[model samples]
Target: MLKASSDAEALRSFLMGYQNTSLTYQTYLKELERLVLWCAHVQKISISDITSDDITAYQQFLMLPEPKALWCGNKRSKRLKSGEVNPDWRPFASELSPTSIKKTMSILDSFFNYLVQTQYLKGNPLSVNKRRKKRTQPQTIERWLEKTEINTVLEALSEMTEPQADAFSIIRAKYIIHTLFYTGLRLSELTNHRMGDFTLIEGAWYLKVIGKGEKPRNIVVVDEYLDALTEFRKAIDCPGLPAFNEKMPLIPMQDKLNPIKQRRIDQILKWTFEAGARRYETLANQEIEEGPKHLRRASKLRKASAHWLRHSYGTYLVKSGCPIEKVKTLMGHSDISTTMIYVHIATNDLLDSAQGLSLQEED
Candidate 1:
């Protein structure tokens, strides 16, 4: 609470110890900021005094969303630029989805665990009960592209006419779309990429990424993806292979030398999805109109996001006889259970015994 600086210092020191990616730090900071604000304003207790009951209330706030007055302030000032202190910030914009709730809770769990390890707090209050609710259970099979959908998207990208005025942007979008599908990198990892992140090891191409939890991972890609990357770089007048020691942005901004932000990447993916969706609609015409309102009615590229391509990557790998554990390592999942979900993809080989072997006595 505002009454003392000791708890604040403890939290600050704890966050200072974090070596995770910037996005992770931002997310954790925001989550803890919400906790501190709630504790100070509503519970009238210090952070050190928070209980399971408080955590339960916080869960409710995440599910129902805080009142507009509580979390609907102006955007954080970029001029200030201090990660720890944001003068105008709101923790919640809307109700958290089940997945979101779990994500937030996971961050908080790590926070309290850190506090406990540092001997700053007695115990973690949010480790039990509320998070165990069925609402947060991960679905067995999440959304991913079918083989037909994948081909449709490729065809659409291939059909892009040359000599367009926005040639650079078009080619860049094609490369990014393919990379996302091939690498299965999270949006943050993709945006955080640098020119030095790529390497040619043993005549194979690999991309080094700082993924979640500040873990470094190497993603191996085939020659086609590497070829596309080289083509894009050469189009922009860069070296065929990115320099290992260079600090230049991997996916550079047109005007600035810096890398583009996640929002811009999201825009690119959205455009790609819509384009592919339109192509699929044309290829498989139906009665329904092809627009946002009726877009969900179609399968394939309908309502897909960049992450769907990632899921498709995992799904494709698992369906193609890759072991779940191997996929887990490649995908950079700390928990194999998270990777196991890919095992249940619709395309998994079905045993013949599952089909009826019954022979009728009198047909």
Candidate 2:
């Protein structure tokens, strides 16, 4: 429990206790600071002067940036020699993406709940039980690799040479990618997975994942990924660690001048780009030649971030004959609505179902 009279003090206390958790405490604290600063600016009052209305107004302002022409944050120049344009000047402010604003708002809501639970505040302004105006559903857009493009990436990875490439490391990275596609596990969950986490149920492989908010779920892994996993484990052959050398890291980076972390996983992705992965190059070229566009056009399919593999997996399964509920479970999504976004069923499939219904009616 926490007790603080003012917003700033309360924020300080809230952040103080969060240092130990693996969650992005620094990033989240910075966002909260931004909100507090904005609130102070608007009210022309000290941080301690903040009230429930201030929090409410701040949330509204976050969603709807000032309509009046305002300066954009500093923009980077493309060329090294080409110096920055008037660093002091701001470009026309663009509205924050709904997705971005929504994520921040979610943070605030959670913060407020924490404050209330800890007795720091009398009431929570963001409480959903309070009446509110209608809000639009969140935009559902995802970038995924096409089936052909996924195969191209796997093929590129498969053809890597030795000396420059270590069979054990490359295979582990490949298996991780395939497992993400087959299991749709979140990045954190994948990182936490041990060899022992996998189980063979009726000869099918399944991996357990601890998803968002600490909820546990199991994802199905196909035979292909299992075979890849087995090969990768055998190649590594590290001893003295339990559960497939659980004490030893599954995919130790060749560049391990330091400890293994998510950043290293990102570096693994950079290596993929070097290994004839064409996605990033295509995206960079397209971004320059083409104007602002949708995600599919803006980002290359193969060079997408690690999470995009999960998106590809979800989309493919839904596009196939898999039920939506089952896909949701495999993806470890708490909400059915989140799973709905990935389902892009073909018109032909829908049409076939309609025809089946018509046949039944005729009978």
Candidate 3:
């Protein structure tokens, strides 16, 4: 139903014409718009004429600039100092990170493929092979919160007084934190959940997640999660609700009937930090620290983010003697090779492989 004024707009229109109900479609449209702008700035060509090299050139352009310098806020809004925000503040170039770049590339590639299908273009130029840099092999760096620090975060939550220390608010913070660490669901995935997505079947709980591509996958829930769910339900008066009401959000916003969004999540995180949970307060400000290498205190703030929990689950699976193939299935990885990264992190079974190495420098 959308109209196009330019080649990029036309392409976006074509994309919109397809199955376009999902959030990913909007993401694709934004990426395409950015790509079109980048192409316009650099090559000064219409989208129909862009070659694969233009795409590669734009990728190179992206890595040169540092990221933006928004102050990563603390509980008291303290400005923790860091390096300059990226100098390349251009609209298309400034917003791109490695992950975002990858996403953009994928969206454009798909768009181009659509052009091919429609016979608007003869061939796809972005199909050309390019060698990506091989970064150094990763070494296992300890990144999880210590048991004592977990206690510290909890104790800080417990120590809140008066108006700031509402029991439901405190419970919400603890559950959200614990759920992320224990379940390893992505932030969007967790927040997007509805009450109907969870079911208790024969005393076992399961999460019916609408993951990438809107594919439904059922994740098994353990006892701890069951307890959390039970507690949350009791707090929210779950028994009174209609069983099949798709409108009910699993985690509703505080004092509202609607589902909690990312803004609420951010507020909860800020509240956690303000309650003397100093380490947790730093989650928003995490970046690659440049310095002489030494073992630094593990930042619970960094470790407690949504993806860290996923990483923890993968790493723990590897460490706990689960086969890589099984772990891949549990993690819902589409590619076995993609799942192999966790294999390297699992230390116990790889001792024999490690024994084969000999490091004698030539004299």
Candidate 4:
């Protein structure tokens, strides 16, 4: 059924379908490229020849990629430059976590299914189930900033200087942070959306976005977000509120003519996070009694990223009594199960509710 003799050729064909969406294309390319490399180099087998046992071995390999010197590279290492593959490039950055392994397996399953449907392969090896094991506890979401840490980051942003050279960048960073927190839009959604996507329906505003799987959804725009948008526009010398069908990028480049790339967005957030961490470190030194607490917050802020804001958004909403279904919609989660992780944030409230229960009879 397969026309492509090499796994590399098959991977190229499969990824071609996703070329229109850069984010998805990149993700698929990363996972599939690693798999092809592993099949050729480590397993000495073709992708079409992989079996259920081979998949099990692959899963174990992901847990701890063997011969780290040959399979792993530093996070900043480049895979390609000027259309040439770098010799230092490695498939694995570090050992994959259980969640990461699951995600990689899911992506591989989809890839194999696509191949099967297109007659490129016979069947998906990943679909063959092994003996069932006892179900383990669900992993809790941990990569989110607490409310106080978020406030510290906000304070750091507020203290940023608006020099003529960096005025637009500073304001844009502020808007990006607030939008991610309030709307929970994924990184790609934020970059792809245009100012025109913010529409007024009746009296309220909503930002329309094409989320994961090309699903369209409108996220409600709160007053604070609108205000941030206004500030961002003013910084860029556009209208205070976006005009109807305004074709400007939601987050523009320094030129104010092009949309900021995802890499730039990541860099901006990283800088902001580091700034917040530094600010906390300074506070820690100043406030002797609260030094330990401040130091801990500084450490967490140092580790925060753009996705952390998304998690923080969902968590804060669940904490604020927002219904799970509504949170799911706002988060663009296709499955309620994906949204259930935020429910863990309510453990304290759930415990508080139990305070009313008593073993002794009440009068």
Candidate 5:
């Protein structure tokens, strides 16, 4: 019943359906390409010919891709250039972690389901009952910045002098940091937003964003975020508040025409965090006795990324007595279980209560 004559043609047809969302399209393409290559070379079978046993073998293969010389390469090495495949490019950079293996299986499950739905496959090879019964491990969110650390980064951004960073750049960095912390938006959601997405409904402001899975949700805009927005707009020569249904990008580049890319956002956050780390390093040098403590703090800050701000937003909300349901809504999480992790993180102090209760704890 398969429509396509070749596996490559069928994959192209399947991928075409995801073209509307560039990120999803790229991710599916990458994962599927690896599967297709594995089938053609290793399994010596086409994608449609893959069976349940083959899927099980593929799962093992993902853990440690064999023939490392042919299947692994330097991370982010170019796979293609000027419309030609790069000979040195490999399917994987190295072995996948347990978490990564689970993710790959999930993607493959979805891919097989899609093919089944389209009649490209007689049945999904990943539909084994054991796989269906596998429970997803609870998500552990360990990466996030503390309130004081966030303030330190902001202070560092404020301290940048001319020739180091321009006035516009400093303001923009502050706005970006504040927005991420306050709104809890994913990187893609933030970059995809337009000025019109921020709307005043019944005398209150809200930002509408299309989150993961293309689901749209509205997030309340706090006063602090509004102030940051005002500063950023003023720096770009826009009104203090955006016009109704404004067509401008929420965060634009220096050109003020094109929306800022995710890479630029990463760079801005990295610079601010590194600047904050350098401040800690300076303090460590001045106070030799506290050097180790300060360096540890510096290391944490250096490891923080844009996603940390989002995690921080959720954690702070849960700590501040916001209802878990409300936090779930604000975060645009499809499942309340995902929001519950924040509660676990916020109440981690409870561990200290049990520490002192042991019968023979202190000798």
Candidate 6:
């Protein structure tokens, strides 16, 4: 067996040889780090020495990782230098859905295959058919927000009063939530937007977003959210409308002029929903008495983040009788089938509890 660091270095070198993009590289690097740590700590061997039995133990560990407190932490990367491994970071943030489990295992198989072809190891322990658990097609809840909860959250954002020092962060969070809800842009699309992306088309305003495959999509700016956008810009001392061809980040860090990372958006919404959850619980207890009736819906909102706004936008369109094809185009779905799910969400509320015919956790 090779030394742990040495084996990790070799695995990274192999993964890097593929010349993956930055996101791809980071993902593979983390998975390889997990395998290396498990080999060293649990199996008492190096990555190159792990067997099929070790793999099973690792799978079980992912299901119910003991010492949950240690396994969880802020999702930010603590170690940034390329090829450096952080063994302390847990591979699975929570229980892996069958879909995630299969993907992780498949990546390990690919890693071992690369090693075998390069003659770094005699055989691949993961090469044998381990029979990955079958996963079914997931139901498309799409993570929507109820209209009442949406209005409640928006009102909550409007009512927030904070100190001068914290004003920018609070205002920025409100703008992000409002813009996402109104435009139905994915979090990636929204974060990538530049100030110059906004334009006045003929009589109406529009915002250009780089969608799923780097395709540019123009979304119409609704009147209300555009007002919100204007207010946000003014608060930052920018013009009511952004300057022509401005280069500053859309949602900069605090007062710094750098675009907030994708993860930062989720972090902001986590607290936003947490606050909204409290308000939601207060409202529910006032109007209803049942323990489970509205709590289930409110609980889901509490767990939701920015993505829920996008889903709510789609569901709203579906409920408004927009043509399925139109919704597909607006949501940037290449396949119509992806858009069709929103229709089910709108029309099949009563049957949803028993829909999909198979049990599968959302990815």
Q: Per-residue CA lDDT of candidate 1, range 1-363, in tens?
A: 222258888788777766445767777787888888878877899888988888888888777755666666433443355566565556664566666787888888888888887777778988665466555455676677766666666667667777532767877787787788778888778888787888878888788888888888888877877888888888878787788766777667874278887768877766666677787566445544555433442444556767778888898888878888879877889998889888776433365545655676756
Candidate 6 to truth, TM: 0.71
**Tens-digit lDDT string for candidate 5 (1-363):** 557877778788888888997767767888998998899889999898999899989988998889888899753435465767678777896787665676688788888888888787789988983565666767777788888889988888888899999988888888889989999998878788888899999999999988876788899999988988988898789999988888888777777778887757877888899999998898899999999987988999988878889999999999889999999999998889878878766456888766667666665
Q: Give candidate 6's error at residue 218 in angstroms.
A: 4.9
On the 0 to 100 scale, the lDDT of residue 294 in model 5 is 79
Give stretches of model 4 more than 4 Å off: 19-23, 61-82, 86-97, 117-120, 129-134, 161-165, 350-363
TM-score of each: 0.77, 0.65, 0.70, 0.86, 0.82, 0.71
The residue pairs that clash in candidate 5, if any, are none
Q: Which candidate, 1 or 5, has the higher lDDT?
A: 5
- Show model 3 residue runs off by greater than 4 Å: 1-5, 17-21, 40-45, 64-100, 130-155, 162-166, 237-247, 270-295, 298-304, 348-363
* Candidate whose lDDT is highest: 5
Relative to the unseen true structure, what is the C-alpha lDDT of residue 218 in candidate 1, on a scale of 0 to 100?
87
Off by over 4 Å in 1: 1-4, 19-23, 37-46, 66-94, 117-119, 128-139, 150-165, 280-303, 346-363
Clashes of each: 0, 0, 0, 0, 0, 0
Judged by lDDT against the true structure, how good is candidate 4?
A: 0.84
Q: Candidate 3 lDDT, tens digit per residue, 192-241?
A: 78877767678666777776556667777777767776676677666632
Q: Which candidate leads the pack in TM-score?
A: 4
Q: What ranking emerges by TM-score with the best candidate at the front?
A: 4, 5, 1, 6, 3, 2
Q: Which residue pairs clash in candidate 4? A: none
Candidate 2, which segments miss by more than 4 Å at Cα? 5-9, 12-97, 116-119, 122-139, 162-169, 201-203, 238-245, 253-259, 273-299, 347-363
True-structure lDDT of candidate 6: 0.73
In TM-score terms, candidate 3 sits at 0.70
Cα error of candidate 6 at position 305, Å:
2.5
Residue 171 Cα positional deviation in candidate 5, in Å, after optimal superposition: 2.2
Against the reference, the lDDT scores of all candidates come to: 0.74, 0.63, 0.62, 0.84, 0.84, 0.73
